[model samples]
Target: MHPAGPAAKVIATLWWVLLGGATAIFLFVAGLIAWAWYGPSGERDEWGYVIGLGLVFPLIVLAALLAYGLVVGERLLPRPGPDVVRVQAEARQWAWRFGYDDAPDRETENVLHIPAGRPVDVAITTADVIHAFWVPRLAGKLDAVPGRVNVLRIEADRPGRYEGLGSEFNGPGYRDHRFSVIAHDAASWDRFLQGDAP
Candidate 1:
């Protein structure tokens, strides 16, 4: 078999990177579309469109690098570690409760603590009428209904404070069915787990 020439090798590399990058970009775009159209109010914004545009050029550069790695040489894509967290939530007549596996006994009212840069799975269920759980900054939303559990995944890329509002109208307090999501590092997470906050 003949060895690939320099130009051929480069072209192949570019193609491979392009494919990977395109895949990533496609997923990102899909998320954006879901967010803008189907996601909650906070997700729909003109700034998101602008931000999407800004990412195009950089995405192209990464795609090129990925292509080069695949065609010209073998490169291992760095997989982010398994840093996913799960927070189970239950909906009752007039409130929401959050619990972590390690600390299931502790319940927080309308406040959820999650680790940043990690995938979070929220299993939601309702004790009564249907309720929706939503957090715009992290990801999309899902419904919480009686006798059923809904799974929602969120990945907060950055650490900060975000808001979550129930998209469903249940009762008079439906408007008050809002909460705050606090994304923190490992240290803060530990503290929260220890019940050190108000």
Candidate 2:
């Protein structure tokens, strides 16, 4: 499936760019090898072409990619916004607990509910060993460490469900450490906050 929001979209774009660049590099090197084996012997030792393609081109491409990556990463960071919602994610041995900042008493296990078409800042930490919160369709993964709190911002383009899990290997129950993200429309999200739904 395609990415649902801006952050995931940026990541997807970066992935495609990397794949294309790698493929191009591979083809160029392969072509050079073929030419060396089968083309005119006198022209096979072209220093200028070898140096330019093997050194200069890669350096330029790598520098450009590094700059592009930094720009995309900066865009994905959590920023203060008027309608931003905050949630806290706590990780244990093999389970996840989500607490809403707006409704302190309301907590849910293994299911995160948020409003669609808006940004959500998820504060993540671990009660036990380290874990990683990863929801592929929405945003990138963030580490959940015992004594550290990391915030990851995510958004859903529409009302739907997305899967998430602890990406890092912890212990015996690591494989079962899974969760779901449920995105609701504005009214449904309000009702959820007001405790009208379980």
Candidate 3:
């Protein structure tokens, strides 16, 4: 529930909504069980309970969840923006390489630097087997497939450091395939772009 960016916020909200839907379903089933065992004897609307409560309600809830996911997924895409920072990410067996669009020759390994409060579009690919790019507090995961690039949108609301990792089980060294994200302020970002340590 500790979300540091917009995408993470949406995902956290989705989790809460899923929990609520599950709770509602559980309560409904429990109510049905109680009614079946302890309620006063009467001719219940069997069709109504079976069709309306059992099928229709669940379908409606599922449809709503799907709609919400679609909308949220669209919003999280790496859309073009004036302030968007583009970065290239290449995943290997147990390492990550991050290169900036502004500084093409400069690349960082296992340490990604992004400006705070701005959307970043990371173009991800893999050198070998498929891997997953994930920064849990910032956004969802995207596969880094060989010979194909996948763009994942991520951002930080403020200047801070966050943890990132490759989530796929590519090899025995996968457990150490971790990284860090340093979200810098405007000045810090500029300095880092100009050859200063972040």
What TM-score does structure 2 among the candidates reach? Answer: 0.95
Local accuracy of candidate 2 as per-residue lDDT tens digits, 97-141? 999998999999999999999999999999999999999999999
> All candidates' TM-scores?
0.57, 0.95, 0.95
lDDT of 1: 0.70
What residue pairs clash in candidate 2, if any at all? none
The predictions' CA RMSDs to the true structure, in order, are 17.9, 1.3, 1.3
Candidate 1 residue runs with Cα over 4 Å from true position:
1-81
Model 1 C-alpha lDDT per residue in residues 36-146, reported as the tens digit of each score: 677667534577575765476557767666656654443221123466577888887677889897577777878888877666778899889999997755555589988
Cα lDDT computed for each candidate against the true fold: 0.70, 0.91, 0.91
Task: Encode model 3's per-residue lDDT on 33-84: one tens digit a residue.
Answer: 7887898888888788878777777788878878887887787777888999
Best by lDDT: 2
